[model samples]
Structures are given as structure tokens and as C-alpha cells.
Target chain A: MSDSKAEASTVPSQKPVPKIKDISLMKAWKDSKAYREYTLFVQSLNRAVHGLKNSDTVPLSPTLDKLIILLNQLDSFIDQCPPKGRSRFGDAGYRDWHGKLEQESQQLLKDALPEQYHNYIEELNGYLCDSFGNSTRLDYGTGHELAFALFMLCLCKIEALTEQDSRAMVLKLFSRYIDLCRKLQRTYYLEPAGSKGQWCLDDYQFLPFLWGSSQLTDDGPIEPKQAIDERFYRDLSNDYLYLGAVKYINEVKTGPFFEHSSTLYDISNVAHWSKLNQGMVKMYHGEVLDKFPIAQHILFGNLISFDPVPKPTGEGLFKKPAPVANQ
Target chain B: MNENSSSNTNGDIDRWLEWIKDCKYLPETDFKQLCTIISDIFFEESNVQPIFSPVTICGDLHGQYYDVQELFRTGGYPPDTQYIFMGDFVDRGYYSLETLTQLLVFKAKWPDRITLLRGNHESRQVTQVYGFYDECMKKYGNANLWRFCCRLFDLMPIGALIDNEVLCIHGGLSPDIGTIDQMRIIERDQEIPHRGGFCDLMWSDPDDIDWWAISPRGAGWLFGEKPTSQFMHNNQLSLICRAHQLVQEGIKFMFDEHLVTVWSAPNYCYRCGNIAAILAFHTATNHETKLFNAVPDNQRVIPSKTTTPYFL
Candidate 1:
């Protein structure tokens, strides 16, 4: 093909090809436009989310101050790069510049106003899917990734709350996530695993199922074989024995059981041994505690609240209190 | 007057008042009540008065019971003079309950001689993370008793003015915290939250610089030396003695020897095999603080017999 024909084919029908200088000028103009728009959006969103009106912006909150420091650091790093207009591939440069601008803008929004940014990202992600069907698009992925990051930030905030608040928030978040998972008919990436190597059912899910079964049997009047599995029976017995030992030891201390670390260790040991015993009973035919004589020491350690206390039957051994006589 | 009968009547009245005052264990049980109890127990007779002699200060016994026993051997048991135990009686160690019990028993037995102030660990949050809450759950199957103990722990005084010289506490100086009374007025009613005023009070560490430094462990801010020195100077205290940091010799002096750290529990948890010690204070013409290693005799080494089944 002739050079003129190739040039003509490359040129668009509606617009004429520009000179290299004009192209560079045009690219600079485009980049500045994108940067201005992006920065304005980020700053406005940040101010709105943080409740920072003109008068209130003098001293930044600790969280906002940290974000500003991070943004300044990013700005300094970005300043080291060559301007987009100077590059040979002006279109590629523009695309790269736009991508960077979007990323930094999203990051700034996330750092400055996390919760609002997260909700915004989630909404943006949904809109991208519905409007463009562009799941494979970089912008779509970036939006979703931002949402995920925001979700993680929320988790961190929830974790950092006071214990009582954290507990309440955890239960609320867990329930909400579980409901979301059910609605989507898919497991959340954050779901904790169960013993059987499956995503653990939500507490709400398991409770209703267990309660339904019990109600069917009229509050568990069914035969043991039908009503309870061997594991259930074993765990029940273990809990009973361990809790009993704990109660007895607490009485011996005459103080809060937790006031001593040894007491907890003893209780944990009993719980562990009970689990081991349950395992052994399920696996072997004979009584594992008797066969492995050392196991007796495990129970004894837990009972006496000391390792190798002289004669396991000392005066300080945690003995069950005698029944109190009625007055 | 019948000298014997009159003296006996006065003694009985004092005893009656003392019993009434000692019955209240809460920290808010009135300073006057505490004064009455202390006066009845130690100051009634001039012979039993606590002299302005030297006494060592120690801090942060996080349930290292054996170490405390060792400390007694090393620092010399109280009653010869006086020893101030700067709180943190429970958590971290396997014997927090035992250690606290022993300390409480000792305090009860020797009311004026031993001083026990509350540390951050004595609060609910520190105990919860460091094993107090779970230990309570396992030991008692109820959390209320732990709650009560924590409340009691919170009511503990922040610092003790020893012979009007050394200031003792679990943590070091904070930029916001300028005086001992500020510490005393801290609402110790709740467990320390992760951040804010309560956390800053409990988690802040000392530094010897002009500005607050970031925490190396990412816990919280550490106050620089300038502020610490300022606080010490402003309070007119010569030395700021504190605990919390684990020192190699169980004690360390920082901030150009202006601050001293004394650890009473040696070989902390058998994991941190450091030499632990207590400070002995004697104020003569010049105040002299003596550091004594407080490791128990029995914990020096494990016995071969105990290691063998035959001993068992």
C-alpha cells in the first residue's frame, strides 16, 4: 500500500490529524483538566464526609491529619514523574495519567473519608455493572477493590472500638454479612471456616435449625440415639465436668476465678483433656483415661490448680462443697 | 483517775471506730476513714509510727508470684521500715490471682507498712486481654466478681508521695498529665478503651526528647524527655519512679537518671529470664535509693528430682 493511503486510512473520518506539537499541547490540556476535576471531586467529598466546613477546617482531626500527611507524601512522589505531554505516545500517556489520577483520587477519598467513600465505591461498582456490563474493565475492578478496602477499614474500626462496643458491632456485622450472603446465594470472602472445612453457618442460621428440631421432639423427649449424636453427648458431659471443676476451684479461691492465671490454665487443660477424651472414646473401645495413666495427671492438674502438687489430694485440693442444710 | 481503767476505755472506743472504718473496702471509703484506720493501726502509739527513714519503691507485679517471693528475700520484707508496691497486681503471669491474694493478705496483715497502688493492669481491659477475665471465667464461672475486683482496682491511688520526694506510678509522664492530683482525679470507673483519654493515660510511655514520639509497638504515643522532666520539675518531685518496661536487670534508670524503673518480679514468666529487683530508699542528709535483686531462692534452678519420674 502507498504511504499516503496508509496515512489516510489511519486518520479518522470526522477529524484531521494534528501536528506533534499540537498533540502535545492538547494532551497537556486534557491531563490538567482530568487532574483538576479529580482533585476537586476528592476534596469536596472529603470535606463533606468529614463535616469540615470553612470555619471548622483550621485544625484537622487526627484521622484527617493522617490522611493529609499521606496525600502530601503521594503528591511528592508523583511530582518526580515526567509530564504526560513530553511522552511520545500521547494517547498512552493520557491513559496512564488518567489511571494514576483516578487511583490517587480514590486513595485520597478513602483515607480522608473512609465510610462515605466506601459506600460511594459500592454504589459506583453496582452502577458500572448495570450501565456498562464492564466486569473486566479496569475502572470496574478499581471501584470494587476500593469498596473491599473500605470494608476492611470498617472492620478495623469495629475491632478498635471498646470491647463491649466491638462485641456488639461484631454481632451486628456478622448478622448483616450472613444475611447478605444468603441473599446473594454465595459465601462472603470473609466468612470464618468451621471444623468440617466448610464456611461455618451463621449463629442465627444454626440456632433456628437446632431449636426447630428440639420443638419437633417436644423439647427433646426423644430417645438418646435419635435426639443426640455421640459428639453432642461427649461435649455435654465434658462441659458439665469442666464447668463443675471450675466452680469448685473458684469456691476454693474465694475470689474471682480469673484473678489467677493458673485457674484459667487448669480450666483450659480440663477442656482440652475432655476434647481428647471424647476423641479417644470415639476412636477406641476402652476408657482412654485409665489406659493412659498420664491423662489422670491432666485432670488432677486442672482440679488442684497446680502442676505436680504433692499427692494431688492435699488440703488445698478443690473439693466439692458439701450441700448446705436448709435453715 | 484510775489510769488503767481510763486507758482501757479509750482503747476500746478506738478499736470500735477502727472496726467500723476497716469494714469498707471501696477506695472512695473516705480519706478521713483511711486516716482513722491508719492512725488507729499504726499511729496511736508513737512507737508504731512510720519513720521518715528510707524505703524502696517497686512497680508492676503482673502476677509473678514466685518473683514476688524472691523480691521479699532480696528487697527485705516490709515492717523493718516500709515498701511501696506500685500496683499491677494481676494479669500476664500464671499466678495473678495467687499473687494478688498474697499481696492483699500481706497488706491486711501489715496495714501501714506496705502500700499497694493500682496499675492499668488492675483495670478490666488490661486484665481481659492479659488473662484476668478468662481466668475469672474459668475459676468462678461468673464475671461479676472480676467486675467488682476491677472496680476496686480502679479506686486505687495513682501515686504515693514517698517522704515528700520520690513519685511512684505504673506508667510514666504524659504531656497532658502534669500533676499527681491530675492522675488521682482520673475517672478509673471504666476499663481503658483502645483510644482517647483513658488509653493515653494507661498506654503512654516516657521519652527524653522535645516532642512526643510514635510508639515502637504501635500501642500509643510516648511522651518525650522534655515534657517528662517538666512534669517532674513542676510537681517538685526529684525522681519519677515507674514500671511497665521489662529491663534486663529488672530495673533501669532513664531520662538522664531522673526516672527509675523497678521490677519486683524476676525471671518474668520463666520466659523473660531477666534479673528483677526492687528499689530500697533511705533518706539521710541526701536521699539514696538502693536497688536489690528480688528473685526467689527456689526459682534459681529446676531440681533434678522434680524432672524425673522417681521424684514424682
Candidate 2:
């Protein structure tokens, strides 16, 4: 190839180049051009999720198998970074643990992605490191969770993850992410950076409920009203993401389910899972996107661009219902 | 408005105590009236009010209204016991409105018995971002009540000096601030600014570093033992008591006990699984500190399916 052709190849026409920058305030996400791009990014996540869910695949997903290995290795470091600090707000070991991950994340991303995507390793590593939590603050919240979700979306964007077995991205890969976050929270006693008591969603998570509700919104007979009924707790939580989140509430908190988890409990009164699903979207936009503290931490990269490029309508995330038979 | 518009008479205070005990909220009009009286009273307080000993210094109520009532039930209610609340009465919880209403009533009724210092969460900008503004709007069906409460927040004192020995503040020290006199000259009675000594007193945190560093919160400095020790030595103070971080044991002593953290919000954010504690200083005896735990959660309220959110 000619020198000019080699140089031109460096700038991929399909993927917009990432605008490298530090963290930004909510204004960047609220302004006209950036807001459109941000909204489009959020919408892109929905579309990518839909693609994965709609794709058909059996067990043994190549993408999840590789990503899970990376996440588990990170989890294994918890033993090395044992909770040794005296202060209960957080353990100093978390910093050590996150530091270890940060040092190896480059190699970890290389190992996780297929050999073909080696070129994207440096760009991808940013999302993975940011997804876990803030190392210095020694805290995790919805912002970190959002970062993790974006990692999976970016995975789909790079085509490292095929449209094959889309649902596993939600059911398997994201499930593993939740498990890892739960372990981090449990091991380090990670404080919720943006917790609003019962006023907000779960301390360390918000996406699971959104995706989980979407996962089972149309899957037969899981009623939203069953949330109020204690009898339904075991059954519903066993099969769906939303109920699983409710089960988590039951685990950590020791008060009346209604009083402590009122936001979710009120959500249960919405009659159907579909409306509840939309409400979850609205709630996420308000609590996670509109809130300055959490949104300010979100960074923009290459795959997730700051350009307002419109796409076809049918490509939305929640467009087609993915089959749950794999689970 | 005039101070008398919502003066806390014995009857009004008794009703507020009842509301707090029941974990119920007052009507918006009643809340506004109480806030007015408290705002008027706060206007009379200095930037750093001087408090004497024999008063209990509690920290970070954060709308754990029942837990606060639990403090009153176990330790003793204000006025009779003499309490100094180191700010952070609202936000990140369910009942910020009720919590402030009850505390303001107590302050209006007996201003000297209770000391209310500002916390990082007290500002209008913060409350709007956190849960308090949403809570007030939803509770009152208007923002007027929230605006009234914000006015009350503006008038709140920044810190307190107990018996001219111990210093009590919501957050840690600042490089911009040298002495207590430097803080006194700061013009208060407005929304907390993005920077300066006023914001640092309410926003900064204590770290184990040697000197002052920028806070991750983007508003104040992350002060260290060097500055804390220097401030205490120069001010001739025995200890600087602060309450911002959620300490697992509810109280943390740093820099060889020269600086202490007292967090009264138990099981912070309803799930921290931590105990809450308050510090009591009996001035007559060289300001010896005594600690009290929160009332064990009894699951007392009959669990009912209500839409209202609850905080620990």
C-alpha cells in the first residue's frame, strides 16, 4: 500500500475519532450539540443491547467467555488486597486492588478481546478501568455502573462481539459485571457516592434493574404488582432482573420493604412491565444523566463519540424482544 | 418575615415532637412557619457561634429523623440536654423536610440549648442536586417550601467554639483559612459559594496527608494533619471536631486525638451497616468526651405498603 493510503487507513471512516479529554460537568451533556451526541450515545446503548438480545446463540459464548475471564481475574485480586484498613468507610486495600487492576488493564483488555482487535486495546482499556469504580475515592456508584455498561456497548461497537448471542451480553456478561461489583462492594465496603437513601435506587447499581425489567417485560406472566406481595418475592426475583434487584434490597436492608425501597415499590404499582420499563428509562435520564455529580464523571471516547450523527429508527435497543431460552 | 410569625411555643414544640416520634411530616404551611422563625433566629447567630460545654455535640443528621429522635430518646432531647448539631440535617434521605422542621422548631424555641452549624449539604445548589429539593417539592406540591428552607440554610452558622477550647465544624480545615477570626469576617447569609473558607468549612474532608490538597469534591481542600495540628496549636484549641465522612464506629480520632470525627447518622444511607455515635463534652471537667450509640432499629413501624420513601 502507498504511504498516503496507510495514513488514510489510520482514520477509520466508520468510527468517529474519540475526543480525548478529562471528566466534564453536566453542562457538556446538556448543551445542544453535546447533549444530542450524549442522548444518541444513550440511545446507541439501547440499540446495541437490542442487537445482542435478538441474536441467536446457544451456550459457550466466545465474547462472554473471554470477558468473564478478565472480570474474574480482577475479582481474584480481592484476596491479595484483603480488607485490612482500620477505617470502615473503606479499606486501603481497595486502592491497592484497583491499582493492581489499573497496572494490568492494558494487558487484560488485550487478553480479553480477540486477537484481531489488538489495535483497539488502548482505547478500550479506559472504559474497563473507569467501570470498576474511582480508585482514589475508593467508592462506586451508578456512574461506574454506567461506564461498565458502556464498555459492553463499545464491545458491540468494535464488532469484537458478533451480533450472534446478543442476549448473553445482558444475561451473561452484564450478570458477571453485577457479580463483580457486588463482590467489590462487599469486600471493600464501598460507600455509595451518590446515594439518596430510599429516595434513589440501589446504592451501587441502577442499570441491572433497567435491563432486568426489559429482559422480562414481555416474558409471559411476571406482574409488576407482585412486588408488593411477599409471596412473589422468591418466585419473581428468581426469574427476572427487576425482582433480583428487589431481592438485593431484601438482603442489605432490614426495614419494611415498602418504606426502605419505596421508589422501587411504587414502581411495582405501575401495572405492567412495559410501562415500568419506560419509567425506568425516564428515571435513569433524571437520576444518572441529569444529576451533575454522577454525569460529570462520564467520559467520551472514540467508539462513543461526541458527534450528533443520526441513525435509522429500527436500530433502537428495545426494538425487538430477544428470546430468554438461553438463560 | 417577623420572628414571631412562627415562634416555637410550648404547644407547637410538643406537636413537632409528636410528629417526629411518629415519623410523620408537618403540613407545608406549618413547615414554612417554623422555617421562618428558625431563619429569623439564625440571623442572630454569628458565623462561628460560641458554645459552652456540658452540651452534646452531634453530627450529620442527614434526614435520619427517627435516628435523631432515637438520639433524643436515649441521650436526651434538646433544650433539656443542650445539643450542638454539627450541621447536615437534610439530603440523601427521605424526610429532610420533617427533620429540618423539627430541628428548627427546637432552635426557635431554645436557641442557646441547640447549636446548628452548616454542612456541605445545606446549600441550595447541593440540595437541588441531592434528594432534599425533590423531596420538598413532592411533599408540598410546590417549591416555595424549599425556597423558604434554603433561606434558613443561608442564615445557619458555619462552625462553633465550645468553651473556647474545642472546635466543631462539619468538614475539615482549609489553607485559605488561618484562624477563627479569619472566618468571622466572611460575609455569610447566602448560598454557599463554589470556593473559599466558607465552602471549605462545610465541604472539605480530613485525609492522612501532611499538608492541604485539593478535595475530590471540587469545592474545598482536603486538609491533613499538618494543617490541623497547626490550626489547633495556633488557635490554642484542644481538639477540632468534625463530621462529614461516615465512620464505621460513628466516631474517628486522628492525629493523636487532636482531631476527631463524630458521625451521628447510623447505618448511613440506610445500608452502611455502621453504628452511629454522638459526642458529649462536659465543660466543667476539662471537656471530657462521652459517646452514645443510636437506638437499635426495632422494625417498630408495622410494615405497610405505602408509597412514601423511608431513611434509616
Candidate 3:
């Protein structure tokens, strides 16, 4: 899974991974406004992702440039170490690989974030560290991926990322993060944590399709049949986010497009990309955010607001608990 | 609802042997009959039923009909070998309706030999959310079959005990269920509740924590050594056998061998890279554990992409 695109000797500085900052020292994030901030965060990301519909020839931004370089460094980093444990499951080698990332995560975040936001690096390192994958389980899922998404949103919250950079973030950094995660999945053979089989949007990803679909919201009409033409998807991917994701889907899954990826298959048949994009967002909220097992392990820090909403204590106010996927 | 109900007097379940063995679907009529027969039998059993020794204990089929057949064949099929399945008979896999039909038929055919307890996925609402409800629609062209299966799940037991020595359940311990008898009066024949003991029995996982904590799964509580030890000791059982979490080796032992998790679906969802296992608890003789890997030749046919999504 080593990317030939990333050259050797691109390692970051030889410094050890930084210590975690005490987030408790920050003002209590559990205040009522925390949920509002969460809503605002999602709203901002929605606008940012939706904004990509108008972008075609915009010049690339600096934040995107730094993220691309960081991805390359991480890309080369994987090539340096060989996998250590069993062939398929329970690979001990991924532990060392992730540990190396953990050790360098603080440095990696510092290198990825713009210089103006460098001072907040200590506070932000915890989420950045959690964004990769769990070494103990040796798996990646929507949970870890959500961590990374929230990590990026934290960058935005701190003004490290801004509305101006949103379009480029999706086009470059977010897409690149998807690429890195894909490489990790294939190279390390990471398990799809609590996969719901083909019922899910994609085995290892949901954000790409969500953001990607938003990017295609204004692009006239899309037919489900168009998704079957792999070559067509590959040709159009460099220009469209949705096509890029479909291209990646084609690369990973086998069998028919409709068979292995029914959710996306259904999306293709929708009347318009705008409706498809809207549906994707709701699906994320329902299947990913609202689901307990995925949301349970999620840590609420200063940026994401570590507040637990007190349960409503009356009839008809029930939260649907997450069933163990695939039993 | 279907007005006519029949008892399991006809040995009609034996008729579906070829369909299940060939990995084919049961006719819708035969499926309704099977569901009716099993529901009648389960309606008589308590929430915490009793089982004798020398039975094969299996866990979490997860709609893997092929693995279900594999386990039965490996364990020396039917009346000769008693089988106890610890819930999760549907969802995720392609042949959920077909697989579940086999278990219902067997329970009807050999009422004394087969025991099927309800797992979390057995509920009507869960099936509607997961693949079973969709698979039934795709295969049978209606939700009638799905409705029958849900009715059967409502009547199913929540847990079972073998020779009063081992307690078997789908998930793990719950605070509400102390004596096995306590579960008896909590009500049955309704959809599983969203919270309380009924939900916990089907959702919780055993963790390494000291006391009961909120389960990450949210529906069930995460119990540590204290609760497990107390549960087994209070019940006067040597071990608590369960299935819910995916164990890479197919079975995992935690908390000083007092709690065992046996996952019977190998290569879960056809991609989990896991193996399946069954516990052979023979009290008449010595206790034994049997493990099996998923069939290497197992074939999965992808559901059609052209199928439109159904929003409920």
C-alpha cells in the first residue's frame, strides 16, 4: 500500500511525541451552549461542504498545501515499517505503525496546522492522536473517522481553519485524509469497527460520500446507471468529489456496484445530486452520529464540547440504542 | 394477522429439510406455518428456561445460514445432538429469512432437543432497521414473512440454564435480573423494551470494569468482575456463557473463566476476519469446548443495486 507518489526520506523531525494537555483545565465545556456550538460546528461544515458546489477554478490555499505535504510524509512513513503480526487479523505490526504515528502525532499536527494556530497545538493533540485508529482493536470505523472530522472542525473553531478555506479543505485535505485512511485500511488490514455489512454507506468511509455528494449538488442530473461505468467515473473524478468517492468505491469493493454498495447505488438513482447530498447528511446524523456504539467512545473536549445532554425523563422521549451490527 | 393457528402435530417442519440444506428459501406458506408452530412452543416456555446436559450451545448466527448448517453438521445433526442457540438469528447476511426458518423448523420438529432464545436483533423494530426486514421484502415480495418472524421472537425466551450449572444468554448480566425467577414475571410476548432488564439481557457486554457502568452500546450496562462473579455465585452456576461481541478466535474467556463469549458466526459480515465456535457443555460427562472456522467455500451473492430504498 506504499504510495509511489510519496518519496523516501520524507520523515518529520526526530522529536518524541508530545505529552497530552489537561483539557479539564479549560472552562467547563458541558455548559448548555456546548450543544449550540456543536450545532454551529455542523452548520458551518455543512455550509463549507455545500460551498464546494460553486468552486471549479479557485486557486489552492496554503492550509491545503500544508495538509498535502503532511499526508505525503505520513504516506512515506508507512513505507518505512513492515507489518509485524498475523497476515489478516490481529496484526501486531499495526500497533508499532500506529505507535510511531502516536509518538509523532503532536509533531504531525504542528506540521499540518498553519503557523498562526501552532500555539494551540498542545490542546489539540489529543483529538489528533485519536483520529488515526485504535491500536488495541487494530481497526478503523466511522468512530475514528469522526474523530478526525471533529479534529478538523476544531481547527476551524480555533480559527486555524476558516470559511475561506472550507472548499479547499474538502477538495484537498479531507480527500487526502480519506486517501491516507484507505491506505491504512489496506496496508494494515484494519477491521471495519462494527460494520453493518452492505447496509452502511461504505465499509470504511461515510464522510467522503457526504462531502462529495454536496460537491455534486449543483451538477445537473445524475443517474444510478452512470455509476456503473467505472472508466467514466475515473475520468470525471479529478473534477467532481462524488465521482472521486465512487471511483474509490470501485477500487475497494468487488461484485456489482448495486450489490456491494446498495446505499450509494440508491443515491445514484435519486432525481438530483442536491437531494442525494441532503439525504447523505441525514444518513450521517441517523446512522453515524445518533448510533450509540460509535458515539459512545467519542470524547468531548474543549473544541467539540464534552457535554452530555441530560436524558429527557418522560414518555415518548426515548433514544434508540445502537444494535450490535451484524449481530 | 393470520387468523388460523395450528399446533406442531403434523411433523410438517421435516418437509423443509431439502430447502434449507440446498440453501433455498422456504415457501411463504411453509414459513408462516413454521413460525406459528415455534411461537406455540415458545409461548409455553418461561423467560428463563431449563436445559439438560450433553447439549451443544451455539451463539449469534447473525443470518449466516451457511455457518448454521456447518455447525449442525460438525456437531452431528438433530435429535441425537441437542442444540441451544443464544439469539441473533437474523440481520446482515443475505439469507436471514432462510436461515431463521431452519431454526424455527428444527425447534418445532424436536421440541425437546432444540432451544432458541431471543437476541437483541430478534425484536421487530431491530429487524426493521437491519437487513432481515429488507431481505424478507426482497426475497418474498412482502413484509408478511418478516412479521411472522417478529411474532416468533416475542415469544422466545431471553435466556436458558443447563443442568443448573451453566447459564446461557445472548448478552451479559443486568442489574434488574437477580434470580432467574425474577425475569419470569417481567412480562413476555411484546416487542423488547428500549430500556430496563429486558433490553439489558439482549444488549449488554461484559467488560473488565469493577462495577456496572454505562455500556458503550448504550442499551446495556457494561459489567465487570464484581457483577459476573456475583451473578454466577448467586445463580449457583459455574459459568455464564454469552454471545454479542465479535471474538477474533471465535470465543473469548474473561474474568477468571467465569464468563465466556462464544461467537458462532465466522468471518462476521463476511469481512470481520473472525472464526466461529460452539460450546460443548456435557454435564453427564466432562465439559468440552468446540471451535470451528467459517467455511472457506462459502459463497455470498450480492443483493441487487437497482432495488429502491424503503423508508419506514
Candidate 1, residues B236-284: lDDT per residue as tens digits? 8787777766665767777887887776655443333456667777662
- Report the poorest 10 consecutive residues by lDDT, candidate 1 chain A: A192-201
Q: What TM-score would every model get versus the actual structure?
A: 0.43, 0.86, 0.66
lDDT of 3 by residue, A198-300 (tens): 6777766777777766665444434435754675565667666667667766776543455446666655667666666667767876677656556566665
Of candidate 2 chain B, the 10-residue stretch with the lowest lDDT total is B303-312
Better of 1 and 2 by lDDT: 2
* Model 3 residue A107 lDDT score: 86
Candidate No. with top TM-score: 2
Judging by lDDT, tell me the better candidate of 1 and 3.
Answer: 3
Ranking by DockQ: 2, 3, 1
lDDT tens digits by residue: candidate 3, B162-203: 988788899988899887777778787889998988899899
Greater-TM-score candidate between 2 and 3: 2
Instruction: List ranges where model 3 is wrong by over 4 Å.
Output: A1-58, A68-168, A182-195, A210-327, B1-17, B26-30, B124-130, B134-148, B193-195, B207-214, B224-229, B254-257, B297-305, B310-312
Cand. 2: chain B TM-score: 0.90
